[model samples]
Target: MILLISPEQTDDIEIKTLHQLFEAGLEHFHFRKPNATLDEHRAYLEQIDPTYYPYIMTHNFPVELTQEYAIKGIHLEERKWREQGAALETYVKSFTDKGFAVSSSYHEPEDLAAQPVTFAYHLLSPVFAAISKSDMQGRGFDVRDIPKFIAGMGGINAQTTPEAVKLGFQGVGALGGVWNAKDPIQAFKEMQSAFAKAYNKKI
Candidate 1:
């Protein structure tokens, strides 16, 4: 499953929470800290169990760090997408040379047109009214609106993950739904079970 680390700060509790998530069968992690400094991010990384999860750094941070940690890949935010999209050939070649897979956020169809650089995947969002951000709209996408080469994020959890899969998402990512749960392990199991149910039902 995809576990998105949207911690406000690199605090002790956040680190502990991340460790728990990693232990709970999460292998894909997205570190999308938009306001953190390089030092702050480094400090957070220091707290994580490097061997367990394929930690993906946001484009705002230094890409070199991923190589240093031997992480799976990097999450290309808007900036990286625009910058790399301009030179897709060179960008893909260099990153692939380093054995790094690429993932990025896509909120629109226009974004899809620009993608073909051998990215491992993409994340589309706000599939439901997310508890973390109640004011944010769920983008009104049901099972019919999903795109190929994409996973669903934003407010996704045990309850909605099944619906997300039915809508054509290959995987699901979570934030407050899992992290803010009264019992994270239970939440993880529920989400995992929901995904399994969807997969089995399809077969």
Candidate 2:
């Protein structure tokens, strides 16, 4: 699973490239626009071909967006997950019952291990130095012992994706690695190919 996260701010070029990416076999697009309002989010989705709606996972307005669009799933940011407290399981279940994939993010391996609520998958970050944020350093987390579908984030690209796999991530997610490249679509394909080769070797 090579998940591509949207850049914080929207750009016309990025949107156009995203259409190309979807056509080029990209799956699991994390539609995260933190600063965008619900209306803006809807506008963004409207721009994309509705046929690809099932391939998107919204990071904001999970219930509302998923209810309106046939997106793949909802991602619970660490803060939102923590806010749920005891209701976390029930909250997650509500979506899972509807046959939606529920995933969450974690910065620490220990925190992920301690999490009681099961997710469709877990996104562990800073496995490698972050490209989008210069100040964030990589922790090189090893999730081999964690019994869940884990995807590594932070500085993931064609070159570093395999390293994440070797560290035991079942999948990898990226943002800058793809959007920052000169050719976003080609970068995605390369990263996708690299992940597949590495994951195959791991098994």
Candidate 3:
């Protein structure tokens, strides 16, 4: 199970929560504070032990931020992905050549189906209603509705991870679910456990 930790707001509490996840063995921790400046982000990165996990920068800031930290991957937003067009694929290919992986977001299955570029995988969203996005509705795709090689994002947590995996999500992304939990580390573990159980039963 691949655990993605995305905190909507990065604060001292959020940083501590992330530290807990690091100790809990979550491999992929994406730093996606959209409102934070590069300097603020750097400070947050300083608190995290980069050697223990894969840290991904969610937006295309400067490549320098990632280069400085030796982070393994970058996740592009939908707008940046659309704007780059062919350049996005070229960028991923270039990163692949350099040993860095790339990921992007796609809301709909057709968008993923239409994708012609290579990425580690695309993140498809709103598998359930997220605390961060209460207004957004989930697609509620069953196993047959999902294609191969897509990660389920939005509202993913311990409670819904089983359903997400049974629906054929390659992995699951958590936002407020883990970050806002009473005990984030435990929440992460339970979520991973759920995915593992569901995945095993499916096989």
- TM-score winner: 2
TM-score of model number 2: 0.97
Give residue 131's lDDT in candidate 3 (0 to 100). 59
Query: 105-185 in candidate 2: lDDT tens per residue?
Result: 999899999998889889999899998999999999989998889999999999999989999999999999999998898
Candidate 2, residue 61: the lDDT equals 96
Q: Rate the local accuracy (lDDT) of all candidates.
A: 0.70, 0.92, 0.74
Query: Which residue pairs of candidate 2 clash?
Result: none
Candidate 2 Cα misplacement greater than 4 A, ranges: none
TM-scores, all models, native as reference: 0.87, 0.97, 0.91
Instruction: Output the number of the lDDT-best candidate.
Output: 2
Error of 1 at 52 (Å): 2.4
lDDT of 1 by residue, 30-145 (tens): 77677878787777677777685365554545465665676676777656677755686686567767877777776664565456666777777777777678787786455345
What tens-digit string does per-residue lDDT give for candidate 3 at 1-203? 46565665656576676677777877776667788888877777787776753555445464767577777778777887898876877777766776777888887778877788877777888777775678987877554554557778877888888888878887888877777778778888898888888888888
Kindly give the stretch of ten consecutive residues in candidate 2 with the minimal lDDT sum. 10-19
| Number of the candidate with higher lDDT, 1 or 2 | 2
TM-score for predicted model 3 compared with the true structure:
0.91
Q: What is residue 8's positional error in candidate 2, in angstroms?
A: 0.6
